[model samples]
Each structure stands twice: as C-alpha cells, then as structure tokens.
Target: MKTNQFLFGLKNLDRGQTMKVAIFANDDMTSNIIFAQLFNMSDIQITGLYIAASPRKGTSSIIGGAISLLRRMAFGYWLFLVFTNGAFKVYEFLTLVFRCSPQTGTFYSLRRAAQLRGVRYRKVADFSSPEIAAELQNSNVDLLIIRVGDILQPKILDIPHYGTWCVHSSLLPSFKGIAGEFHALRTKRAPIGSTVFEVTPSLDEGTPLGQVAIQRDETGSVFQHMVNNNIAAGKLLASMVLQAFQCSAPSFELYTPQSQLKSSYHSWPKPDELKVLHRQRKALITPGEAMRLMLAAFRWG
Candidate 1:
C-alpha cells in the first residue's frame, strides 16, 4: 500500500494563476534550509515571510536555564542537546559568514535566504496582531506554511485560501511531539519520514496531504541524522506545495478514529532513553562527522 494518496488530480497552472505563498519560519538552520528549497520553486510566488523570533529570556542566567533543562530532560540528554545544538549554531554562523552564494545544501539564515531571493521578510512579535492579518490580506497570500512558528489562531489560519499547512518531522498521527525522530528510532518505527499536513488547532492531528519516507543512518551521529531530516523535510514540503498547486482543487484525506487514537506524544529524552541510545552505540555527534559536514557546507557554498 502507498504511504499517502493525493486527494486531487494534477494539472498545469499558468504564470498568471500562480499561487501566492507565505511562510511562518524560524531563524534556525532547519527553517532556513526549508526556505531555500521553497525559494527555488518558480511555480509559486513567495509573498512574505513572518519570522518567528526567539522569545526573550528576561534576567535568567545561563545556570538557571541549564538547571531548568536538566530538571526536565535529565543531565545526560540535556548535555547532549547543548553540545550538539551549540555545534549546529557554530556551523550555521560560519556558513552565513563565508558563503557568498545563495545555493542549497548549506545552513544559512532565513534573513539571508530572503535577501538572496528578494522576498519580503519581517520579524513577528505577535502573530495575532491585527497588523499582521492586514499584511497577509494585502499580500493576498493563498497558502501559509508553518515551517517554524508558535501555535496559530483561527483568524490567521483562515486568511489563506488553501489554508495553513505544517511540515512535521514525523509521519503524523504518530510520534506527535518534539524528539519525534528520536522516539521513532528507539522504537524501530517503519517507513520513517516527513509529513506535510493541514495545520489545525489540535497539534499534529491535522489531515496529511502527503508523506515521503526518509531513511536514517542509525549508526551515525544524532546531529547528522537531524540535519538530514531537515533537508529531506524541506524537499518534501516543496514537493507537496508544487503538487497542491498543480491540482485544480487540492484536498486531504482525514484519518480514521483508530489512527487518531494511535497518535502519541514524545518529549525530550530521559536518562534511561539516553542510556538506551548509548547501548545502541549511536553517538550524539562525533568530532569527525562535524568537521565533514562543515567541509561539505563550505564546498556547497
């Protein structure tokens, strides 16, 4: 059986009938990678980008933040995230600084992507603000993609004619939270991949438009696996958007009650899970793998 079925038939759209798309994206490498893929698409017109800025930390000290993460994620998993995430940040920073080209395959900022593609980009503090809604209305955005952003309200979601969509890292209606890939790996889930789904008020419970299987290298570092997933997700989402536009009228197949009941949420890994990961001999990220990725990024640029 196929993993996903297109609910609408495909057809060609003329230049004048191009779909106007907007993105609610984050500043991180994952979001930027996804943006790069979408920016390269000539069929859809990218109208605007609403950058989801990181929330302020106020007066919280580094130690306080570390302690809070430790309480929830445990020391082992927390340290793993810090080290790997710090490495990713450094990688992203160097790519933006050195790369003069707007090519794909490297980590770059969303701002950089916008500047290269000549798309309108703005940092969004409050998504529910009337001003934001007005901007979307003025832009005549037909599709709104939530690559990275907070939970959206119905008012904003309803503005897009094709409705709001989200790209989840997992094949949802299953593994519905953060660390979705991690949990899928631990449980040996079959057909691990990404899903482009309709964004509803219920998180990760929306009807899926399509899914593409992404095979992971379990023997490799978690950091590398995550980066690979992000790249695959970007391509999958771009393909989804293209397919949606090709159809005369796009729609999705809702999940049955049994599938809805199977939706499970996973949080950050605990100490026990970390132990199991180690038992599998999967390092968070080896120094060699990090260097290789950086070199690849440089070459791609």
Candidate 2:
C-alpha cells in the first residue's frame, strides 16, 4: 500500500504547481520557531513535521547518566541553558502579563501555532528511519527543511523532489559544527551570521544557498547572538524556498563550494574553554546594541 501511494505522489511531480515541504526538527525553541515560520508560507505546502524524540533518561545505566551529566556540567552547558533560556522565558511571561503581543518563539507557543493552522505533525525516534522516508515519499514532499535535529542519511536526503536543506548558525566553512555562536563570541569575531544550504551525506559541506552576516555587537552575550543568527537563518530559508518555487527547476548548481582549507569544525567547549567564555562575557555588547545588529542583519537581505 505504501509503495502504491509513493508511486502516485511521484506521478504528480510534473504538475509543478505548488511545492510541498516537510520539516525535520526537535522540540527545542529554534525548531519550533522555524516550523512556525515555514508553516505560514503560502508558496509552499507543509506536508508534515518529523520531530526527533528525546532519548529516555531512565533507559540509560546509572554510570552512563552520570557521565552525561558530568560532561554537560564540565562544558558549562547547564549554566548556558539557564542564562539563555531564562531571559526568553522572562520576556514571554512579561508579554503575557502586559497584554502585549504574545511570544511565539517558545516551544509550546509554536506547537500550538502549528496546531491552530491545522498542519499535520508527528514525532519520530530517528530522522533517518525508513518509515520517515516512506511517509515523506507518500506525502509528495518537494523539499525538506531541517532545523535542530540529528544528521540525516542519504536515503532520507534523496526522498524529496528538491532535496533536503538546513540552516547552519554560522557563516560556513569557518564555523562548521556545533555551538558556532559561542565560539564566535569567545573569540571576539566579526561578521557573525547564518548559512542556509543544501544537505548532503557530508556534514556542513553542503552547497550554500544564501547567507546573511550581522555585525557583532560588542555588548551582546553569546546566547543573544545565537538567537539572532537562528532568526536570520529562518528568514533566509524562507527566501531560498520561495526562490526555488519560482525557478524552472530547483538549481543546486548555483551554490558555491565550501573551502575545507578555510573551514574549521568545532565540538562543544571543554571545561577550560568554558572558563574562558565566562571571562569573555564582559566584552559582549549591551542588549540595545545587539538589537541594532540584528536589525542590520535583517536589512542585509
């Protein structure tokens, strides 16, 4: 039955009327924001959402759990999460109390937004599962948009008509993997930005679609800059998707190749690196300056 459905979907590809898009993401705030933004677009139809389920803590052995916790703490991840998420939560709460515009970036708020729009959503334990590829095939998805989730295999990557794409939170190939904004902040770098690119079996080596670089505000925390980069990525993805629909064919050839010599991949910071990050926090720009930089980045598009 699934095979027949998949074939039927393929048959309709020649119509090229409206693009069908599917989202692969987690339940984090960034994923929620990307999903909400893509869901509201008129040029593309969001077929379904494939959300990566969090691993069950109870299933892990005591030693494994301890190690995981220790690793996170050693990297100052707990402190980072509290520092970043706390501010957003406070803003959300204040908006509610003041009867102002509700914050839509929260996980629950965006999930509810998706529900209100009558979009189909699902949770999957693995993004590269054959079941997921089958479902996306059956739905006739022309494009796949990945937010904050695991690396996808080629089987899933090749399922969509236009192929898969993702938003990397830094200007690649400079800062390729994980916690890009934090690295930029600690190093006092300029031209902090985001990249929207095609997804490949390789990591962040995919062809670049569009990029937006924001000037670094000297007073902004690493967390605030991270948020701004993500928001900019969401907008850039939307623009790229719209442009894809307007073209005769989705043009993968237009993207520039990433230079490995100039690129660097990063893992999560170590304990000593966290200490450096803490010390460097004093150099971040004020909130007002961060806002100005964010606005400037948006204007670049």
The CA lDDT of each predicted structure is 0.67, 0.61
In candidate 2 the C-alpha lDDT for residue 257 amounts to 32
Which stretches of candidate 1 lie above 4 Å from their native place? 1-15, 55-71, 75-99, 189-191, 248-262, 293-301
Query: How high a TM-score does candidate 1 get?
Result: 0.79
| Tens digit of per-residue lDDT, candidate 1, span 1-301 | 1223333422433446887899887545566776677887889888888875442122134345445656677576677666544544555555568754555345546665667778898877667679889989999888888865367788888888767888877777677777666666666533355677878877677777766556767676666666777787887777668767777354332233334335677877887987777888877768786666556454442
Against the true structure, candidate 1 has what lDDT?
A: 0.67
Lowest-sum lDDT 10-residue window in model 2: 1-10
* Candidate 1 local lDDT, residue 93: 59
Poorest 10 consecutive residues by lDDT, candidate 1: 1-10
lDDT of 2 by residue, 1-301 (tens): 0011122333344445778888877545555554556766787788887665542233233234334645544445544544343444444344445544323332223444445566677766678878888898899888888864367788888888767778877777777876777776676543577877778887788767667766676666765676677777777677667656665333322223344225777776667767777776543335664454334322311
* Per-model tally of clashing residue pairs: 0, 7
- Runs of candidate 2 with Cα error greater than 4 angstroms are 1-16, 55-75, 82-108, 248-261, 283-301
